[model samples]
Target: MLHEIGHNLNLDHANSEKGKEYGDLSGAMGHLYASETHPMMCFNAANTFDDLEWYIDRQKIIYKSSYFWEGDLVGVAEYDLCRTGKYVAIKIPKGTYSSRGRYDYYISFNRKILFNSGTMEGGDQVLVHKRYTKSPSKSYLMKKLRSGESYSFQSMTVHVQSISTNTSPGIATVRVTKETPAPVKPVTKHPTSNPTPVPTPGLTPGSTPDPTLNRTLGPTLVPTLGLTLETMLEPTLRPTLGPMERLVEHPMKKPLECSPQQLLKPSVTLQGPLSGKIKHSKSSKAKRPLQHPAYPWNKHSKTSKTKSSLNHPVNFGLENPVWHPVKCNDMLERSCINNPLFFLKVKGRRRNCAWLGRKKWRANRYCKKSNKSRKMVCRECCNSCRICTECSKICSNIKY
Candidate 1:
């Protein structure tokens, strides 16, 4: 994964096919698996040293140069190269020119890259060169400086002591010295107060009072006192008319009369355009009672009676006075065989069959015999069975 990532970062395979044979794993490229030791390129799960040196050398030479500079008594005319984290070189000329005034020229360096260009050289000492020119444009001519190179112009000379291309492009120290001084200016003192005092109009020694001030400040004592005295001497006056009589009134007009002929004529009723017919009140119309559908249990009651009659002892020849066994085929018969107490007992009391007293002949014949046994088999043989009744009466004379 790391090898593929190195390839994405624009790193190519090494030239040699050997592994870590000679303490240098920088040439282990194009192989399937690299040695587990050092960092290298083009190997699976391997760490080689070649990638580290390649990045370090690339960052050393990769830098952007600026065209602007700053210094005291010097106007810097340079370009701003917008890049950081790399080494760079800046060239500043030392000369004097008079555009606004006479300004001495020199170079000032700092750690921060103002306008993106600052001191990017990574070394303990940086060498500078001096170039002399009669014109300001000629002073800007700067060439690339190599390691251990020296340049001289007029009385000033610059020497390249050493250049470093391997150090990180971080904070570095810079040296600045005064190459020229600025011209001096003359000084003058200003007066503290005015020489002559101007006089104010009303406040002056013999000036007359203004006419506008006299009109605003004059008093009206006589007219105010005369009006108050006149009101006190005046007599009270009484009203001659009442409130109702004093109101203005107009004469009343006679109302117009109507004839009987006009009253006998029919008045036409106004109808809306969308009205279909007039709606009558609910009290004015006859109402009928609402009917509901019959219940499901009522419709099944007749069918249930026929099924119950099939289980009666009369159909099984129990009416001959001798008890006979009825077949346990229907649901009531099966219920009687399975649960005898359901038909023979009512809650806790034993009673005769429910149909014993209802039918005239069966009620008179077995009304007394139905109390002998509270079993459903006795009721089935006696021909007095009643399945839908609440009574628990059974025929006691019959055997199970």
Candidate 2:
């Protein structure tokens, strides 16, 4: 019953984790699950007494003595308080022994409560609801009440007669009285007359009329004679090409041919007695300047010939070093020759030709003779595999 009364007072459940679980035993609108004491709205089984009835009776007395009475006088009671468009005043006294839900009572008055109490402390003030129909619950803290203050609402005037703070439960005596309507003065009616119609002069026949007034309302035709001639005589805007266009239009000039005599050759004048002996000194040095001992192509000394020299011989000329085989190993003997040109062609086949031996020679021969056969043979022989001294001899025996 108390819980229902709390709902009537517009009281909501006190929200908390414990309130949601065990019950909000502290507030009047709390639930009674597993709680020993029964607050106003709690559902405890121990609350079997007629205490709620007594509480309702006391509430009725308080309502009759306080702002609820003013609300009743303004045709706003507890049941019809939430009804739209109804306005009433509710007076709440300080230190009143009511339920813990004061917010519920404030909400019940809706916007009727005048929260503005100028120059008065909020704790010491009284709450008086007036003729406002909207809910001030959203912003009720902005206004407060003071003692001996009178607020007029529509035809009713709510006056705070006296506030007795000396009493145990402070009594704020408020009086609600209907305001008397002011007498209105009589308004006198005057007589109105219609004036005579003024005459407008009509256009006389065969008389010149004003051009401004006689002008046609349609759009005026503009003379295109001068405009068309000016547009036709206007110069055409020709697009200009950028520097890149000139660069692309003309082809670049060929580099000038440089003769052997005019070319900047490094001075190779021999300072020693062996000067005229090296005829092609420039070509020889330029072709193979850094001669490694392992490169048989560069090392042309007869005594320094490699072990493969037994199977293939190299010819050293004054101008260029060449390869010539006196006796070829395996089936390659028939294909072997002492051609100086062929020797020159296959001279620097590979940088590591001395170490690679016959495998390198076969790959170089295939590359020169048959371009198609060179692809497979060169790929197999000249790959990542290193020709060891033992493998070089074994490869020399294999016919390509």
Candidate 3:
């Protein structure tokens, strides 16, 4: 009766580390076999209780610890599971979230007291359980730790320092620490060619020249080979080139002589790979710049045509109960059930149309969207539809 009540309250079966359903002997949800005898049956796992978010917020039974991160050095905190109104359990959240989009672990101490009188295996140790956002009612056993024992997961490590049996209610002290990855060394590259010092006409030898006072008259052209053409043209003694080496020259051997204003103006001739001429107007009328075909802001670009999150239609709950049906035979894909998690929070907390028991009218609004969720729930709520003939036998028992 208690277990069935737990299910009605949205609590799913707790699984053991061995992957057995209802195998977590520490909780009331677990069944006792003919050979096993546990007189003291405790409440459900901490994660299962946490799944009832409203209960956790209202009861205020556990102490919610700050999030754990890499390189964090946490102090010891004591927890008493047998009593409430104080810190009965400690919930430790890591910096990471599980695939189900919830904190991965819940730490709680389990000790026999009151209705929890049975001496279960690993009862004295602190138990860790996993939480899933999709199934808040379900929790999986992860680890059982004793004094001086530790459990390492991801970047965080939890250590049990001591278990005190001397107190009326057994207390367990735990410490959390995070291991940060070692820093990587940056690679330093040596410059292929150093900038030539521009000599100031009036500066004395061995004295540093002011860079602002000795700026270059114009930009210097450096080739891909790292040789400055202007510096190479100087009247200095040159080294003899090897037989394997050949000197390359610019395609345009003659330099263009232009006024200072002409150098700042945009050139009409397209250079390099383009090799084209652009039409320029003598009038002061400015023309819009040409955009690349793949540019995101271009109206005709493919990227601009992609649907954005804002374009999705809003879902306002149904005013009346109505059904819209589709021919299952027309569907190219087989009628298959989606993942249990796929329907979770589809319309925000407790607003899921398929899961809504009495308020099914709300489902009418959810099915209006042209998405997978519409098909998954609309067939049942809006219209009575039969399974497709192709996969009828295999999918007969499965619900959308």
* Number of the top lDDT candidate: 3
> Judged by lDDT relative to the true structure, which candidate is superior, 2 or 3?
3
**In candidate 1, which residue ranges exceed 4 Å CA deviation?**
1-139, 170-400
lDDT of each: 0.26, 0.30, 0.43
Candidate order by decreasing lDDT? 3, 2, 1
RMSD (CA, Å), candidate 3 to true, equals 34.1
Each model's Cα RMSD: 38.1, 27.3, 34.1
Q: What TM-score goes with each of the models?
A: 0.14, 0.19, 0.36
Most accurate candidate by TM-score: 3
Better of 1 and 3 by TM-score: 3
Q: List clashing residue pairs in candidate 2.
A: 67-91, 89-129, 112-130, 115-143, 115-144, 116-143, 116-144, 117-144
lDDT of 3 by residue, 1-400 (tens): 5565567776778778766888787776665444444455655455334655423421222122443422111111122233333344455543342223354567666765556656365576777777554564456778988888888766556778888766755666776555533557977697568776986587566877576966568755754566568878889886533221311111123222322222112434424212332332333233422221111122432333342222222111122111111122111111111212212222233232232222222332122122222222323221122122222111222232
**Angstrom error at residue 54, model 2:** 6.0
Worst 10 residues of 1 by lDDT: 288-297
